[model samples]
Target: MKRNLREKTKRNIGLDLTRIFAFLSVISVHFFLNTGFYKIPLRGKRMFILATLRTSFMVCVPLFLLLTGYLVSAKKIPLEIGNLKKYYKKIIPVLLSYGIGMTVIFAIYRLRGDRSYNLQKLVFGILGYKEYSWYVNMYIGLFLLSPFLTNIWASIGDKKTHLALIAVFSLLTVGPTVFNVNDLTSLKAIFAAYDDNKINHLLPGWWYNIYPLTYFFLGAYLRTYVDFKKLRPAKVFLALILIIFASSAYNIWRSHGGSFQIRLWNSWGSLQNTASSICVFILINTLAPERVNEKIERFLAYISKLTFAAYILSALSDKLVYSFVNANLGSVKESMPYLPIIILSSATLALAMAAGVEFLTEKILEKSVREK
Candidate 1:
């Protein structure tokens, strides 16, 4: 019993590592995007390294969704009124924190003469609008639809149901990319518009619905069907190879004509990104070795627990950091060389601030909640 318990703990720890890595990847992406780091020319090797990091980090969002599906689905947390209540209790704080935090950031920006607001932007931001906020919105939708989605999984059973759902999801994922009709309402077009206009688009409201439902169902299906015990070393290697080749090929193709927009469209698809995420998932599950997995798992568990706080604080930090740097250093376009340093410094500072805030919230604020 002792040995078995130790082994189980080890495995959970390994899973946590992968999760932390995913979050770090997210941080890296945001760092690059908000800063102009990727634009720098670092001769040949450095340029190649930065490019690889940028491309690989793109998997962060999909990996996050996949993990969400895996965890929630595997736990088989039944969706009920009680569950909904609990979910709202958990999510409401995040939404409220994000709103108040962003509002302050926006107000500061406006004061600095960064006038990019209108009624639409204000409405959307209040409603958790903007690109980075999509995950929050998506999760909210998932929580709201959890009962229906879980029921669908429960009714369908494992094999037939997951397969059927994947098939439908595949169509939903790919259909928008291939066909475009202005008169018709395409999921792809909506997602695209959201990407282009951020809060300015009405279509994001629709696309946000797809994130949680699709991911929740996918997670539930995977939890029901995928058997880590059945996996072998050879199969794991093959999956890894496939993920590498596919991701590399796709990245290369994307380099020619792809942009963030294309990647966003392909995010929901079970193509390279999905394959990569699953491969990492499988690799972590079966062959993570013991020590490495334990370390990663512990770190990720910490980060995952604090992810909501990190996200909220990170956004606020990014805006503030960006505004401060831009103001002090002049326009980023002109201060290109200093951009990377500023972004990195700002991210570090933001992460530290987030950690501090989380400590207070959990220890002090949460204690107050318990007392109440």
Candidate 2:
């Protein structure tokens, strides 16, 4: 019954697996994006199947938020200058990670002779955080606020109070997102006045942008409370599948057999995406052993560290893998049978490149520090 998670030095194999899977899910989503999965018409079972896969992998970003809450919520950040310094020291590597990632990615594009990123765009793009670095931008804010968020969660008087907070946050963030409609024209024939952003008219959409906080509080809740043994993992797995299928089916139906648009529950704040990430996070922690082989944990620990860099550098792998595949196959539909392999190839390359980049960056930083 340790109250301080920092004191618990042993690794949670479940979290390691979660981190790796989340990074893979990120890469997998790009597989869909680069291959034009969205352009495929929702005709027959193929779109449904592919959409279902896409829906399942859509847990990418939320998983990281939940992981952040679980790992950081129990931190003991006191009101002291030393504590603040220690706190920020942890964030510097992440900042460095993004910097290295953005620079490396920008350089790769420049080297490849991509005219889109000229000298001016390169400076502005990296300074503005670039397109694929949106998650990094979001995470930097969260990381900065996590200490205060931890204080709020830790100050709660009781489990009931924490549950109430979770409920209210859910209403403000998840409710609006899950209940909203993206396409107004499709509904205009029926509702006449319906347009974008009307479905959650009563739910208060002002706070919907803070959905990451909802998942964060959720992870904090699970970390501080919740008995994993009591909740059946089998039931959870079934619910995960059901939610994925239901969400995917809703998108198919909403699309009206047109281009497979992610119209329903495909967002970070959507209920289905939130629930799926939670379910997988819970199942892994509950099912995985308390400890793993030392050798394997060491390997996974290294890989887990690289997952962030791998994610940031994923566009490099995506371009390399998809460019070749698409040139050969002509379309995503024609390459349906090789979807899994293509995804694996892309993910593998990202990890491989991340290993090199992370190692080289570490050595470079170490050398700079030594010189200083």
Candidate 3:
């Protein structure tokens, strides 16, 4: 019994550390995106440095989905109203924080004499729509669809079918996305006939965006069936190194010539990105220790509480933070010397702001509910 308890504690520590890594990676990705670090007019050494870091963190979103699947599957709970209620109980507080943050941001935008508010923007912000929290929206969709998803998983009961499903999703989402083949004659003509309005074009775009669900399923399947802990560590490490190298090489090669937008879109959906993400997920899971000291465990727990808040609030305030950084840093050379410092400072600032906003908002909401 004592041995079992020790093993379980170790597993929990591993899981917590992965969540923390995923949280930090997401922030790092946003830092690059908002600051336009990748698009900086740099060459040779500077560009190489930026590209390496960018490639390293490309696994952020996939890691998130995989972790989500791993935890949800471990629950082995019935996907009923209670599950959803529990989800919303957690989600709504986060959304409320996001809403409060956005209000302040929009007010700042207004104060800056920028009156570009539109109906679409309003709806997106108010409804927590598919603008910034795209992942959150996708996860919510999965939550709503969990019953059917789990039932299908149980019914299939084979690895081949799971692989087949993954392949189909990849073809639909990753294939067209990476290859930039959505505008092909076949696809265009099909979409032209299907919708004169051209809303979805030829293929159903929603099906392609179901990549998160694919990751969720893949993560759950691996956790349930794969004894990754028993795998040869040397081989797993080699495979991970190869995957990262290939993915980074492919990204560098593909950066030859394109507008930044085109490059960004393709890189995010590339096959190499998928391979790298899965590799990182497995690497993190397999290498996570079965034990950690109390100090580390407590630190992980504290930061994990702020992950969702950090994501939403940072995203909402990215533009402002970017502007502030650009104003202070001025040029690449000036900022390059202390780039790590800048990133750490900005991330810390974001975390502090997110925590404050969440705490105050939660109190206000709770007080209002109590009074009513």
Best by TM-score: 2
Off by over 4 Å in 3: 1-11, 38-42, 77-90, 104-124, 128-131, 177-206, 232-234, 257-267, 316-321, 331-334, 360-372
> Clashes in each model (backbone N, CA, C under 3 Å)?
5, 0, 3
Tens-digit lDDT string for candidate 3 (208-302): 66677777777778777777688666787788778776655555554542212234234554566677777777767678776677788777776
lDDT (tens digit, per residue) of candidate 2 on 37-95: 77878787766787788888989899999999998997888757788778977776677
lDDT of 1 by residue, 64-173 (tens): 67666666554444566786676557565566555654555566557778788655676677685663676776666666666566666676755865687776765565
Off by over 4 Å in 2: 1-8, 115-119, 182-200, 368-372
Candidate 1, residue 218: the lDDT equals: 63
Q: All candidates' lDDT scores?
A: 0.58, 0.81, 0.65
Looking at model 3, how many pairs of residues clash? Answer: 3
Each prediction's TM-score against the native? 0.67, 0.90, 0.76
- lDDT for position 27 in model 2: 82
Arranged by TM-score with the best first, the candidates are: 2, 3, 1
Order of models, best lDDT first: 2, 3, 1
